[model samples]
Target: MEENDVLVTVEGLSKKFCKDLKTSLWYGIKDLISNIQGNKNERLLRPKEFWAVKDISFELRRGECLGLIGHNGAGKSTLLKILNGLLMPDAGKVTIKGRVGALIELGAGFNPILSGRENIYNNGAVLGFTKQEINSKLEDIIDFAEIREFIDMPVQNYSSGMKVRLGFAVAAQMEPDVLIIDEVLAVGDLGFIMKCFKTIDNLLDNTAIIYVSHNMPTVSRLCDKIILMEKGQSLFQGNQVGKAIDMYYGSFVENESNIVFTNGSIELLTIDLLSSLKMNDNIHEIKWKDDLLLYFKFKLNLYIDIPIFRVLLYDKEQRPLAIFEPNYDENLLKNNNGFLEFTIKHEGIQLSKGIYSINVTAFKRNSNEPILRINNVLSFQIIHDEDHFQPFLLSSTFSTK
Candidate 1:
């Protein structure tokens, strides 16, 4: 694509956040005291200059969808804010050619006290639509939101999902030149999400999409290119969406130590996949009968009590499918040097083919509560196969809908 085809250009963009600058009880108290004393000096110490996005630069071509992937604190949201003019960068230039509409945070622009119908008009106004324009689009927005009965009700009365639906309807109907979305797809049911995706796909021709999500497979499917962020810097930018995802997760797990088990307690230190294992890996691998071992190393911290290590699997919808916590004898684990291992046998793993997360919990002998617990330890996938599975083999065919 020619350089002139670029619709969004970001150069040396950076953002900073400060722990001290956060709004806390102490900060609120300090601000109150400062106001009382008329002390302007304390305001100087409020803190800025902590870059959340550091020297990040990239160009997004027209009609191209760019995915942003990163860990929680990474500058994904910060960069999105800058691109949408919600937040200005500390030291960089961002140039955009078209009218931008965003679905960043759910209900970000809605007034709680206002009726849903009123909020739509308010948001439409902010997007440069006049009253007549909003009036013309009101019926369309209401139809898309599927909130006909409650449109006149106060927004505070709406559920979170309803709020998202209304907010998305307003933005989507605006027909902006660019769209920025951040994980709002995570809300609502699967059917609703699919409808929204279909709507956006139909509008993709004239719009450059900037999407931020932790769901790597979805990103790979929808985005033409991907950008990986870690800490405050862009780690990778490439068309090979898979490579960017691998680098992003690889960077994520680097600092964490693998699990170690000792005594009678097993501690799952690190849960990572083989080089072949990726976020985009098939969902069949996550099934009950998959050959791939969930390689986990646990440590028995103390031998005073028996330990039971459990692996729980949940589907993409976060519904618990199966649980395995084979209890081993105290004598079975003699060494406490952190080299104990456990495997979830493939005999009875029953899950439909889709993405799943593994949650780990360790319980002590006869104790109702777990001594060590970690939620969402790892995630894996299962793939579709033409052959109907043998009894012990994982099933291939499953539908996302």
Candidate 2:
């Protein structure tokens, strides 16, 4: 790689976690005793280690957007924390060519008790920005977040969405050489999200983005490369974004068999589509007006009165478009299976011929709500006929009618 091209290099990076509660408690006491005894190794009782990230190596070049994808608890966030200097790897090393800016959590370093303006200064200082530098960017940050009126209020008083907007605005304006983002795209309103994407797009010329998101379409559009990670191991690493996405989806499907949960009395047995589904050239194609059906089978180990289920749909931009619940009565008592299903039909959606996600939920019939909820539960694409020949996007002309 050219001298300027190579931005970040990670080598043999490994992070181990401890699983034993008693051992952890013992170690804590031992450390206290060791501090009194002045013995460094006195507290060291070696317990078995759980490797969250094990011996993963990769090179990220400047101006390249790298998409990191994995299931929950799959070590994606751990890797980002290590890269952002929040956590140190137990083994191996990470080297960066320039200053780092990270958006790991919404309002991560913000003090809840402090005003938004105070937190901005505090966070900016932590990010290596001088007081003078923060002063210069203060107006821009406030303007971008569009929260000028609430700038003097404590961040704890801000709504979840407002906090996300302000936090993202600050991080994006930092203009670091290496930017590490973890699911920040999952926040904010649609207009703010579009603004975030544009800011990221503008930074693509000088920054190396390590983007961790659940939106695959956004990943495909923004990232120059993709990395598929599973169970703390890098499964695939290359510039082939499409193949990596396919691998991610395949892993998701393979792991479906492992979703059998014994925690609650209800168990999700099977989930499948009603219509014939075809994924064409990395794009799922379904008839424009077909109703989306989901078949679900669950076994109830305990007697419960009134179970409720909710199904939701999200556009490619991750906006909630619709929510569905099956029409049922007070007769849904006891545990039965084989004939429970839900359906969704979007009459308001005037798609520009693209893919969309379907989210689902399952709860008790009446008494206790939200038994099981699933997001991005299903996916389908809409295809417009060639002869219809209308601008296929959601615009004034199409939606106004």
Best by lDDT: 2
Question: Each model's TM-score, in the order given?
Answer: 0.62, 0.62
Per-residue alpha-carbon lDDT of candidate 1 for residues 1-401, written as tens digits (9 for 90 to 100): 34337889999887666666455456568657866986534122245335688888888877889999988988898899899898756567899987888877655568999999899988887667899999999999999889999999999999988988887787777676778988887888787788889988886777888999987667867888888888889888878776676565544332222233323355555465442234543222433444556666765665545456677775543457677646566565434454666455554354444445666767665764577677667766554332111212444688898
Worst lDDT 10-window in candidate 2 = 254-263
Assess each prediction's global lDDT (C-alpha) against the native. Answer: 0.70, 0.71
TM-score, candidate number 2: 0.62
* Deviation (Å) of 168 in candidate 1: 1.0
Which portions of model 2 show Cα errors greater than 4 Å?
A: 1-4, 25-47, 254-401
lDDT of 2 by residue, 28-77 (tens): 69657866886533112266657788778988888899999978888899
Residue 167 shift from truth in candidate 1, angstroms: 1.0
